[model samples]
Target: MRKLQFIILLQFSILLFAQENEMKWQEKQYPDSLEAVNKAPENHIILFENENLRLLKIFVAAQKSEPIHSHRWPAVMWVYQPSDYEQVFYTENEKAERIPVQTVAMKKNELPMNVGFPVGKGDLGLSKNLGNQDLVAYRLDFKKKIDSSKKITKPTGWTWNEDLDGVKKAPASHQIVFEDEYTRILHVVLSKGEEESVHTHQNPCLFWVVKSQPIEYSEFKMDKKGKLRKSKTHQLPPLPTDQLLDQNKISDPEPPHSVKNLGTENFEAYRIEFKK
Candidate 1:
């Protein structure tokens, strides 16, 4: 009876060891299914997606470290275990470089998060080398889908206190028509021989000519590196009212300049600037 009991205990120990070793891997696996291959003993939380910008999350127990593999997507990661020390290395145009060191120390037990922009197609492989202890992390992938409609409805700017006018006039000249907290969006209307009131943007802005008949225009402009600098003006030919304004045609840093309509009918345009 004693011998049989000892044999049973030994068998149990062997099975547990085998299970632990099976969890460790040093090679990558290319599974056909579009899902994360997780085997670590730690609490793994993964957010991944396919060709579309949809998101996913996964968690699993893990043991030993695994060999790295290629992951080509914009991602944000949070390291939940071990020391807060984290790092990323990559290749750009065939040249390899490790991301800048995050000197900021993480709180004890606090998760570390990282956001990666688009990377070169040639960049390949990612791995996490753990120390003596088990590894744990939570990765969040943000792959926002591009909306073409946003391209059309992108706001230009806000209407300023002075942009609204008490008088009605139509001709070809320069004018200041709109202002708002949003720096990148602008709504400006132009009339012949009109002059804009002196003002300052303090930030970048855009212009879209919505309506222009015989639409001669002044070049848009912005101040120099210095703030409160006066804006200079440039003259431009009239744009047709039937066509949509092409944003790419205008030069940037186009601010502070006054507009002058050089046409028989009124000219209207919108501008949008990006924020930091």
Candidate 2:
């Protein structure tokens, strides 16, 4: 039994070392400067970037193709604006891996949020929008290395400036699509005029503003019985703040609060909380 356990432990350690090396190679081969935004400057735009993650958007007009480029890191891309369309990506360096144009469908006003995608070492090449409408999609890249043994002490309930965790108290809106030892990523959504129940985020977070719309944020105090006391409120800019990455802001631990969508369209954001 001890021998088996030792072998398993050794294998896990080897796996970690291999992952670390692969990530380093991936970055070197496809440095940020050569990535989609710079490689095809007109189409792929950088939305924001920090040590933890980077967010960007791709805009391809009807029947147009962005230059052959590469995105170093894998991404969890969301359903696009005017979501229904056809797109063909020619990949594999010489563009030998020709991808069949597939119809990406979505219902009216549907926010097609998804995870674990934009794969294959840069979609491998250039993208061509085979539709009439202008195509727009947000792509988020996780930059931090995924650790296998990090954790957060799971909270049980709410307390003043204490518990009241975001995911625990408000799971519907702050939907966690992916989580690992290093990070917890939530696909947060709020319909127009919808307001979330008060909750608190204990960790500092990096945000990818997927939907650009206005919002009203309010912070409050909770008594022992959970009744709300006097609070303060503020108005946040329409998300994605601007075409400029610096316009979008991140979050640090704050008091118990609620966020309400104050726009005509649904509000969407990728909230990446760092566990380290």
Candidate 3:
């Protein structure tokens, strides 16, 4: 009887340990931003956390001369640098190999097992669980335990909508490149030699760059009585402030301004402006 009791206790202990391990294995969705990116010497990683601090989105960034490493978790990474390279390894087996990442823009691919993703200048590639970069990433954690039956989805990543008043064009068609979602997201794309007249928005806002380019910007702030206004612009200011590499914040009473695409290629930007 004593031996049987001891065996029963051991089984209970094992069951408890297994339950704990299962609880730690959770999945979630993450926001898109630079803060979500985890940077390391070997590579760059991004983590998306839910409202409860749950890991959601994962990204990886790698430079030349990097090795093919294991991706313990599943993720999607967008490559920004390097033009040509390779991911050399076996998908079902463990071996070192090279895999080319050079392809058309807007290409999405999933990598299985350990593989090398070659990158090039102005090339963007997406992959999962790869690299050892200690980079910060946008994260979303769940406060309460989630159900496996529940379906998870990601946000629009970035989108644009008209203002509350249904105004598509700002004060001036030339001044406002594009305006939408007075409270949420606004996207603007400018081609080379495109310029807008001076104007302001209904609320405070922030500008984010979706694509790359050499561009210029200018802002004119109007004072009370509409007489005292100042004009200023900067050349691709630091990210999030000038160009959003990650997250952004816009306060109420949105400011007004005009922008122009000074680069040879077209400019793509997103703005999150607060509504009254």
Candidate 4:
């Protein structure tokens, strides 16, 4: 009887190990159907998608939860509106593993809660919001393997209050929200009568307007050194709020220029860039 019981236990252990390995996301093992947008459409809104990236807007109201879903790729999540929440990860045998409650809050004057998620087993699950406030965030998924050889070493002066990046030569208005081997998230805000220093994107960037009004005024044109062609300012009509602004080419970057806000509302957006 003792030997039989031992054999049964060994079989169970082997099954658990196999299931754990099977759940890992791999280039050949996973399918697009398991993505959060496809599995939990109500809370995960797909804004834009391509072979390299997928931009999603996540919204979970207070006292609510998102359905079980999987994010098969590595990602960086920029949370503009945050709330306290708990995480529940499903196991291979359909058991629940509940993570401790985490509190997240965002302030208007301050930056949002920036997070980086690594590729893991596909046993992903829902996030239950414990706070009364709604949890809204933008998630950018890296659909392909990000080259580690192209990682950007943190510049000598990278800081929360000041950004020494060549692309963000202006004051603290434009800054890096988070940076990892996989992705870089930037935040830019320009108030009325304010202008950004002459700079250009070093990488292909996907931009999304976070806060703005239809009537807000802005313009981006060529600039020489610190000088602007006074009348040559080509006005850029503000895109509607919560919309993804598309850009072309992964190999191509934006030309160096400056932006002067000429409206009452502040110009705000998140820019997701890649090193490779």
Winning model by lDDT: 2
Cα misplacement distance, residue 85 of candidate 3 (Å): 19
Tell me the tens digit of each residue's lDDT in model 2 across 49-79: 7776776777878767777666676555543
For model 1, how does the per-residue alpha-carbon lDDT over 15-98 read when each residue is reduced to its tens digit?
A: 443233233311223232212334321333322233433222222223233333233333323232344322232222323333
How many Å off is the CA of 122 in candidate 3? 34
Q: Which segments of model 2 are wrong by more than 4 Å?
A: 1-34, 82-112, 118-123, 142-144, 147-163, 208-214, 223-227, 235-250
Best by TM-score: 4
How many steric overlaps does candidate 1 have?
37
CA-lDDT, candidates in order: 0.35, 0.62, 0.36, 0.61
Residues 91-174 of candidate 3 have per-residue lDDT tens digits of 211232224422222112321111111111111223333333322122122234435454323123312222312134443222
- Write the number of the candidate with greater TM-score, choosing between 3 and 4: 4
Query: Alpha carbon lDDT of residue 227, candidate 3?
Result: 50
Candidate 2 or 3, higher TM-score?
Answer: 2
Decoy 2 TM-score against native: 0.64
> What's the alpha carbon RMSD for model 2?
9.5
Where's the lowest-lDDT run of ten residues in candidate 3? Answer: 114-123
Give lDDT: candidate 3, residue 117: 19
State the lDDT at 270 in candidate 4: 76
RMSD of each: 23.2, 9.5, 17.3, 11.8
Model 4 accuracy (lDDT, Cα): 0.61
